[model samples]
Target: MNDKMKLKQFFPMLAFASLALAGCGGSVSKTGIELSNLDQKAKPGDNFYQYACGGWIKAHPLTGEYSTYGNFEVLIENNNKQLRDLIEAMAKGQHEAGTLEQKIGDLYNIAMDSVKQNKEGYAPIQADLEAIAAIQDRKEIIAQMAKLGSKGLPGYFGFYIDADIKNSSMNLLQIGQGGLSLGEKEYYLDNDSATVHVRESFKAYMEKMFTLCGSTPEEAKRKMEAVMGIETRIAVPSYSAVQQRDPEANYHKMTYEELKKDYSGIDWDVFFSTMGIQGLKEVSVGQPEPIHEVEKILAETPVEDQKAFMEWKLINSSAPYLSDELRACSFDFYGRVMSGKQQDRPRWKKAVATVEGVLGEGLGEKYVEKYFPAAAKERMVKLVKNLQDALAERIKVQDWMSDETKKVALDKLASFYVKVGYPDKWRDYSGLEIKDDSYWANIVRSNEFDLAYVIDKKLNKPVDRDEWYMTPQTVNAYYNPTTNEICFPAGILQPPFFDMEADDAYNYGAIGVVIGHEMTHGFDDQGRQFDKNGNLTDWWAPGDAERFEARAKVMEDFFSNIEVLPGLKGNGALTLGENLADHGGLMVSYTAFQNAMKEKPLQTEDGFTPEQRFFLAYANLWAGNIRDEEIRVRTKSDPHSLGRWRVDGALPHIDAWYEAFGITEKDSMFVPKEKRVTIW
Candidate 1:
């Protein structure tokens, strides 16, 4: 038989024993299988929770959302496989682009295009060291910073660069502000390890820049060392402007006048001018302390690097807007660092990204119509909804949660908004300059454009609700309780995660579960702190809150007990919310499928029933493997569960599993009813 036939035959053989519904590896209740038809059996990787969660493990093989779905990813992948095969057959004797085959085939093509435009795939970028020689004046030295932000590092993106302050633990900083919603940094300190990595990386990267600009090799090395020394001192004073203004702690929220007093070096009028905001005297601020400190430090720097740095910084700060040199600089630095070769991505992907970056999200929407398409979004949306309904049922059954708390929980769940495959509003990149050639210069111009935008926001109103942090092409999804939103970009809609034409079981079990997982995040342990308004509030009664904590504690301790690696205590605290989401998401997705079947009877055209396909779909998601070193590091650092455990941790919570497989006290997944944990 051919590969297709072989794959078709293996479906039932692989799924038969696993259908007891004890967990992810089990079958019978997954797709078309009724709870009544389960055959009590043990399968591969038995006696281990890893196999029980076979579905999840297979789905989240990659770091991104499609593979790392809560449950539905595998189903999506299976669907995609079917579509891929069909498309391939259609293209075997036809042209590449015009034929429908280009749809699936273009995933790599687009990535190649983007990578080529920005990466140094074949060779290093042409950075003119002579530009450093252009600095005849002292101010010219600081002007070099214009080149730095555009070309070298990725520090100022949304993530934090923290410092561990003695006696000042990061408490009270929970919720969105805690990460994005927490109090300002002056409450913390610099010498903290949080700042250590960023400072060192910046210094190292800047030194490379200085070296690249040298006239002689010896001079290059010496200048590089000097630049490193200079950057280190600057970094000691550099703190995140945004972190200081987090609104949750009642931070900055100052007017134009107050902010003006706080950071004198940053021209309030000019910054406001950049962002197109007017009033500043009475508005709220996200951070005041860090902004104040940055101003003080900027004021104190020596005249040479300080002045040029400020000017260069001023220009580079304007994101989505850039000088020609800045844009060229960006392309060079990005193109060089991302790829070993001078170019990596294909031209079309690069064109798309560049167009999306400059033309705004509408262009992306149009691009996706031409490229990503709506069918992918529809598939993802369906799975997400199924999982959501399932979670609602799970919450209804939670014995520990009081009815009042459950009501509020249900309210939050009901209010959850889904944004699958790109945002309605694209970031305004029209202000950004996109010039020809000079990759390094283009990047610098872009930095100036972005920096200006951020500074402008200092005086502007709160974050735009329509604004999306992740690019449309990015393969990731996030649930922001502060915003009460879940965003799924187009990048993650392909392969190994989602497909429009896979077997129902796999598509729903895999990608459907993933959608459910992200949706579940709204009600996760930490996410619960934020009300439906996306503000931090404790609507749950004290008693319910305590009970919820108690349930979460069980989860935390459960993970803490599992040794992912030697001596590495699973940070149950960090992963508690994710684990909860994983558990709740899988349970709900399964139920949703059950509901779907009741309405439609799950008609199976092929040899496989929806039930058989579901388990296979789940397992297929976690089909890939990882390196030991990679696994070890992820265990220590990543908040999400390991690929294997994510499967195990979620599966045992399913009540249907115990019913289907007759799993008893002897089964590792069997938790006494009284000790069972459930939250939705």
Candidate 2:
């Protein structure tokens, strides 16, 4: 659901839902479920995930370049090749200056030019570093931070313009807790061996980066300590992943005057003006406690220490785009130490990712033309409709939810804004200039261009429901509660997820579940707070709301008991929304599969019934090998469960799954019928 894509077992046929009819002719066409992908030695009743996906996991072992390699990474690898070709073609061709093609080609070529990057070393960021060093007062520090923030190097806190939770229509500037380099608060606070190792490696990494940025060893150590001290103080007040999920707790709308009166440590006017934002009225302060802590740190910390932290921020942010040594050093700590990746991605892959980040929609427009088919979009529309109908049917029969709540839930479902394949309006990147400058310089300009777009074009404006957060070429989907929308980009509509030759059972379990998963997000713990119009309002009857929470607690508790790794258990509260979505998706998509079967019943393929194949297809979507380091990292950071748990931990709650594979009470993974989660 984040940004990963999946591609497996390509087929020749271009047909859609009609492909299921191929099984009605007394024989199955290619079911898109490869027999080779199944582990014959494993038993479904004991370990469904291992049985269904063990072969795929064994076949695609984790490589040095990846911490977690899965079906998603396979698709990413394929998409990378496609993107490389497109950018390489543009680089070879002579296009007009200022054109998107020119910008795309120039940016990729600049990023890939290792010789030039190594020659430039840290020279590109030297002026910015010196400017940070020259800051004398708190006002100057705030201004410098804002200047760096505009180029995406946020310091103490970060802000974004998005639909206000309550307002839902007007975009509001929201600032939140930040400044932690290791991301989560647990990494800094945890006494576990793994967390301690990561923290120590990060400290060493900071010192090395400071030394590389022209500091002596002693000076670098001092600066590293200063930055770590400020960050640790910020972390003390920062919200945990679970706590941040509460919309009501996070939202704190305050006027500019109130902000100045309450958090008067820094000059807000200077901060906004430096970022080219003028006459700001009000903003939603997300996590006031952390911001309060940040204010205290800025006021109490010495000027020299503050300057060192700011300079370190600049150096740290610029390291990846700097010389080979800097990039490797950064990766050694982040990629190798934190995530256990043995090597960095290829230069072409890095360059392609950079171009995609800056000019995604511009490149996506061309990508859809070349790779995305009109038929795919048309088929996806039909699939979404079926899933919606299935979810509505389930909603009508929910005994726990009262009639009043059901009516409103149905209304919200009907109001969904579904975007498939691509956006009707492409983003205008004409103003974005890419020049024959240093790679880091071009990246800085790109960041500035993006910030300007958000501030100038979108800030305080009405929310554009049609506007997509992800580009068409991204192999991911998202459900934004403020928009009450679900988007499936063209990049995910390929083999495995949405195979042209797969039967309805396969498609229903794979992409059908994906569609349902997003739809269910609207009814998840967080999304349920927002009503049909996407405003953060309580539309539920008081009794029904209480019952819903009680039911959701069951799901939370169920996942909390699962041991993802040795001694480390899952954080159910942190992953509740996604877990609920996964459960609801199975219920909704399975019903839709049955509805499709009413018209055309699918025959057994590869010695498995339709129901068994459905579950297998669903499990195949999550097949992958992951490093233990990644397991711990994702457990802390990712909202979704790990891949193995997504199948094994989730399927035990599904009633039909037991019937599909004849799972008995004696089975180790079986959940008592009374204890199984009933909420959708």
Please give, for residues 409-514, the per-residue lDDT of candidate 1 as tens digits: 8888888777777777545554554444433445445545655564454222343445564555444566766567777777566544555544455566766666
lDDT per residue (tens digit) for residues 1-680 in model 2: 00001000000001111001000001125787887778979989899988999888899988899998887777787788888888999988899999989999989998899999899899999999888888877667788888887777858887777787799888888878778788888988899999999999999999999888799999999999998888889888888878888888888999989998888986888888888888788888888998899888778899889888888778887888999999999999999999999999999989998888779889989898898889989999999999999999999999999998999899999999888989999999988889997888887888888778878866778888988877787766777888888888887788678887778988999989888888888998888989887788999997998999999999999888889899999999988888898888899999999999999998987899999989998999888899999989988977788888889988999999999999999899999999999986
| TM-score attained by model 2 | 0.96
Segments of candidate 2 deviating more than 4 angstroms: 1-29
Task: Compute each candidate's TM-score over C-alphas.
Answer: 0.60, 0.96
**lDDT values, one for every candidate:** 0.46, 0.84
Question: What's the true lDDT of residue 227 in model 2?
Answer: 89
Best by TM-score: 2
